[model samples]
Target: MRKVDLLDELRSEIGVVSDKCADQVNDLYQFVCESLQKKMPGYQWVSIYLVQDYAFVLRHDEGERILPQSIPFGEGLISVAAARGSMVRERLSGRVEVYMPFYRGHHLIGVLVVIAKRANVIDEEDVSLFMELASLFETKVEKYNS
Candidate 1:
């Protein structure tokens, strides 16, 4: 499928997420991880890591999980996105991971990490869509947490 089609499919999936689920952020993360992994087989790993006490703590992950509980403040791709306050995509050989920083208002709170085996799994447009999804996730959090 084309990138737009894939993204639209994801958008449709997430669009139906009841606003009530926002209170359970970990559950919300799991739901999204399962949804994306099932819909897009190329997606090898889907996870969310929150910035806790100056460290990137692994909050949730789905499928073939092997990441540590916490990583150094400025290590790995997730850290790069957090430090730069923007999205960062890394490509190596035939695998790729796109890290997008998730914000709680103006304050950066966490990072959304999407991994795929295919070399061309994502592009600029997809990054934009993913950012939209991240914003949606944050909105849900804000509504639920308030």
Candidate 2:
């Protein structure tokens, strides 16, 4: 398969984002994570975490290893995006990680994290596009939850 660009892949699925009901949102998370892992070059894993009780709970993931059930909502590799409400690009060990937050209006609800198997597979531009996509998804979420 041809290497896919993150922005292009997300744009191609513009119409695929469906209802943001509780159950449907979970399916959407799984779908988005699976799609990213399959199509995005160097993206070895993808996960979406929802926050509750001041922590992040891994709701969906597409990868080999299972992550912890929950993590404290603060400074950390996975919590950076949700903590800051912005995209964070960091190089840990040798892998590049991009963390994007899912916010509804001003309240943060979750985080989308893409882990790259290779160094520098994703960059600032990719993060920007991902943020926009997250915003679109957030709109649906906010509409339903409010």
Candidate 3:
């Protein structure tokens, strides 16, 4: 399938999955991982890092395993997103880091990071889709925390 079609499918599936998993935390993470694997085939890693006490804690992840699931604000992609309250896409030779901020009103809640094998692969469409997905995840997290 074309990249655009694949992205659309991912976005639609993410929305459906988010709605279906709204009441459950594990389900939401599973859906996100599945969607990322389907949408960005070259992504080597994907994770959701939540903001807690002004820091980012890795709440969920897929692809390569990572330990120490927490990082201070301004340490990595999650921190960058949380600090800026915007999407940050960076490409470095063989790797790509895409950070999407999750916000409820003006408060930044978390970030979603997609690490791909090929640099410069993330596009505008991907950013838009990621933002939508991040918002869904944010809502779920907020509801779960409350």
Candidate 4:
């Protein structure tokens, strides 16, 4: 399916699911990881890292051991996004590293990391969709935590 179609399906799924908070978040995270991995063939790993106080905790992941369970705010991709509060997409020889921030109002909630097997695979459209999905995840998590 196309990216738009995939996103639509995910949004529909999100709409129908019961509000179980943690379960929903996990489902959403998995959905995003799977969808990106499938749609972007170059993407080898997709993960969400949530910020808790001074740390970025790995909430979920797809693909190989591309991320640690947790890292400091200024250590890796997670910290790059957290510190800048913006999306960072980098192209390496055979991998593409992307970091999208999850923010609610002015507070930064977390970061989503996408690792592609090839460089420059993450485009503008992908970044846009990732941001939107991350926002949705952040909103739900914030509500659940409140």
If both were scored by TM-score, which would come out higher, candidate 1 or candidate 3? 1
How would you encode candidate 2's per-residue C-alpha lDDT over 1-146 as one tens digit per residue? 33345467566674355543344667677778877777776787888888888888888888754357788877477676776778888888798878788787888888888888877788666677678768867976876677
lDDT of 4 by residue, 1-146 (tens): 78667657655654555254454677777667766676566679888887787888988787875878888767976777777888888877778889988877788877889887777667776777777777787778777667
Residue-level lDDT of model 1, residues 1-146, one tens digit each, is 97679879788767766454646777777777778777777788888888888788888887666467798887887888887888889886688888888887877778888888787876676678778878887787677767
- Give lDDT for model 3: 0.76
* Predicted structure with the largest lDDT when compared to the true one: 1
Candidate 4 clashing pairs, residues 3+ apart or interchain: none
What Cα-based lDDT does every candidate model obtain?
A: 0.78, 0.74, 0.76, 0.75
Report backbone clashes per prediction: 0, 0, 0, 0
| Residue 30 displacement (Å), model 2 | 1.2
Candidate 2 lDDT (Cα, whole model)? 0.74
Off by over 4 Å in 1: 1-3
- Tens digits of per-residue lDDT, candidate 3, 2-55, equal 988988878787777777774786687777876786557787888887778967
